[model samples]
Target: MERRTAEDRGTGTDGDTAAAPLPGRAAVVIVGGGVLGASVAFHLAEAGVRGVLLLERDTPAAGSSGKPVGGVRAQFSDPLNIRIGRRSLEAWRAFGERPGADIGFAQVGYLFLLGDATERALFEEGVAAQNALGVPSRIIGPAEAAALCPYLDPDSIVAAAHCPTDGYALPREAVAGYLRAAARHGAAIRTHCPVTAIDIRDGALDAVRTPHGTVRTTTVICCAGAWSAEVGAMAGVRLPVTPLRRQIAFTGPLDTPPPRIPFTLDFASTAYFHNDGAGGLLLGMSDPRQQPGFGREFSREWLAPFREAAGRRAPALATLPVSHGWAGLYETTPDHNALIGEAADVPRFLYATGFSGHGFLQAPAVGELIRDLYLGREPFLDIGPLAASRFDGPAGEGNAGHTGARPEAHII
Candidate 1:
């Protein structure tokens, strides 16, 4: 895999030509050039939203989307996530063929193991929901699970859910493909132009103020991901999005790597490891009490959980030293779900943030949903539970004893 560094791309200063007003105007303005923003730009342009302008504080794919573990799976506990993942997988399949870059999309399948009866029940419910949505997921016995992944210890797994359609996609390649295709379709995407503030009056968005200059557009879509709260605050809306740091590590290449298989998540151990498609392993796990910030600074200490979990699940990695690591943030919400759809007050302003840790794999479906919103059409999947207004008024259920979306103790 090609690692993207700061030196390879411009520092988002390429288009900073004086703080002059932008010429004419765009029908839609998208903030943040990461996967979510790029997908929206591409889809908006495809939906006939001409002169769509996308602004990024840095170069494209320089945020969480660039540094994510690039694992795609439809094996989610929530029905909405399953729908989104399925749609995204469909788009990825087509995207792999007609692309400027070959996004390494592989449907090696996913193995979500269960440790106890309660966990097995949850997995079964999730698998049923997936089946109802036309997703190809099923509950498999321990024997079947071991058959699918020979290295797995059947004795450790109480039950398992397997989804052959669950897969992975190279992040940068997907972003580049969408950007190039969107550019060809007539969208003007600009990087390094950070939107400093948003102009709002009467609870409606007027325009966006960026470092370069003010860009006037009738509609604005906020896809800032980890920095979504900052953009929402510009319009006087206290979005519930919060940034939480996460870390991932890579192992040295193995002489005889395990056979290619889909990503596996050991729920009991809170462990996840997958083949890097090059004889190495890519792994990650979440810290129960991780700090909330945008800075990439991380400690080597975060590797403890991953190392322990890997050793417990796959002892072969006991001697493998961590080659390198990457740090990123998860834009979280009160429900641990995304904040999609238009805000109740900010009429022309739409958002797609708070994806938790599933942004990279879910980008394709998110783009299509945003496109539907812009075209005055209903989203392919219901987005009612993710609106910004769901957090409004007296703070209702949230402040009055309702527990927020706590991360699963097992899987981060």
Candidate 2:
């Protein structure tokens, strides 16, 4: 995951596309073909927007979206995120009818294990907030938590937040679905095309340059995950995004299949696991020792700390043999939340990236938000707080009219 260029890999899930070839000019040019980008393309094209061009660095979902085990939940500690999560969940449920593709979505639910009283109290508040937002998440005792996932060590967990609506799905399938629908609606999706340069003249978008050719477009939406900072720079907009590597290991087919369970996480250690729905389990953790960078090579060394954390929470999973693993980039920002809003300085450039780890779940709703923003329609939610200018601090004369760092407050 470099600055401008995209990784040269996609899952090739994109089936036959009734899309167009590269055009000299387009009404809207989208950079990045991941789930978020593909969603935006579908929403915009479905809205009858013509001349829409989506350029992907590689195939769609070749980035982080193709790697991680998709966890969809609305049990956020904040209202904004919970709303986004809830809305996206509803959209994911209705995806098959409108998008005309099956995403393998399962509402197997999400369980967050809390280790201490402090964490318990925090989750109680989150559960209340989720309830208000129509998310049926409840704070339960360790006994109930262990009942849902038999592998859990009941003594290790003090409390848990369980949301039956939250679940896991296929990320690459969702991306391919969106791209296919977008293409059907007259959106040209060009793979292996990265936006090398963005030309802005007199504080307005001019064109987007790539290796294939340059396309003239006034509206450019950036869904580039880890490499959004460089795209922002080319357009004179500041998007402070960084890439951090996150890894996951898979236990190959086992003689005894794992019990059907929720996507469980040990909040204190950030350790998590889920049944692959195929005979084994997928295990992972946010390694605290990992330094932020573009290094995405999966390493067994991190498994040492992972096992320590997983062992403390679930004694049975600590000794599971890891058949294979992979490392992917988590596009992180200053606050570990997402960057979703139009740039005030460069109005033509709208961005939706830097989703610490919530991008997959929030993509569906964010697509509608971006589509509404581009169409000058009032979106269902007030996304003013998510403006990139929030990090700029004070709308001063020399600061290019940034909205000032008002703290988006989990506006993912």
Candidate 3:
């Protein structure tokens, strides 16, 4: 990919000119210009912090932030996730109303179809957990699920969990909004400026080395998404994040598109489909055999399984011609959850990566949590459950008690 700055695309914010050069230092340097990093920068600047520099190896939303199907929801098996989802939903709604940064956020809701007794039980537990956290999600019968999403095959679904306030937002637009807001608040965003190394002295952050120049800063936040592990290594922190490839296919404009349904998912097979909002359907399924790597090439072999799953769950979409599709990486951790906090060993080196597939939807709340951590204030949300220390131990030996069932069960 060609490296280009925000100025090259004429997207530079106020006070940023096309001919401006990168500064030698800043109070805080954020690596990665995706939604997560952009949100952090925006929140920090909005909190009265000055001289904030956000560096992107490529343009904003060039990673998973730009590639997801854009599903947002508050339904989760974990309370932390549910709380974060609730706050993010609020932030998305506020962003949609903000002038000059209207992210097209739609509360189309999310429907998780349960196919069997075990799945139904799990969803019931999830709904209870979500409701306890103030999320208005509940278990609905197959009839109600099918009525809400007419294309679904009621015979195949036993039960489902629905949350009307959950929905989708344009990831690119969210990133743009955050970037513009951050820059307008005196945050300098430098795209295409990748960090080569992080300088550490006496177990503390010293500076950040980049191709453009060395930035002497005491704080650095790694929001590099899939590349977070590599970025963490520079600071001598072993981040347990690996990039998993995921693909999505878009069907051609249908003669009769399905109803404007919620983002529907089959909990058993991890198969999901939703309206693309442009008279087409977007579909994807997790490949059980997919290995961890940076490879994002779309595979023709997976199409057969995708069709089979989609056909079994929503028969009407089985025959639709796939018009186009793309692939992106998911920054997955061992438990398929995010690692968010400052490193215990590496001073001033904070991280917010490893969301598996839900990072974009959770970025808004994470930005505020990170800002709180940096400012030494109590965060609005409890982020202790997502600390990096949870994985601390000998390198090869697994942490037994910590290794439990994955918290985020609805990965699709």
TM-score of each: 0.89, 0.91, 0.93
Off by over 4 Å in 3: 1-19, 98-100, 394-408
Ranking by TM-score: 3, 2, 1
**lDDT string, candidate 2, 1-412, tens digits:** 3432111112124432223346999999988888899899999999999998988877789898898778888888777778888999999988889787888998899989889998898788888888998999999899999999998988997889899998988998899888878877888888877789999888799999988789999999989998889888989888878888999999998889998999998887888899987799999888878898989898998889878988899988999999999999888777666778888888768999988778999999999999999999999887876666666754422331232221222222
In terms of lDDT, the poorest run of 10 residues in model 1 is 8-17
Q: How accurate is candidate 2 locally (lDDT)?
A: 0.83
What global local distance difference test value does model 1 have? 0.75
Stretches of candidate 2 exceeding 4 Å from the true structure? 1-21, 394-412
Could you tell me the TM-score of candidate 2? Answer: 0.91
- Candidate 2 clashes between residue pairs 3 or more apart in a chain or in different chains: 390-405, 393-405, 394-404
Reference-based TM-score, model 1: 0.89
Task: For each of the candidates, give the backbone clash count.
Answer: 1, 3, 0
lDDT of each: 0.75, 0.83, 0.83
Structure candidate 1, residue pairs in collision:
12-192
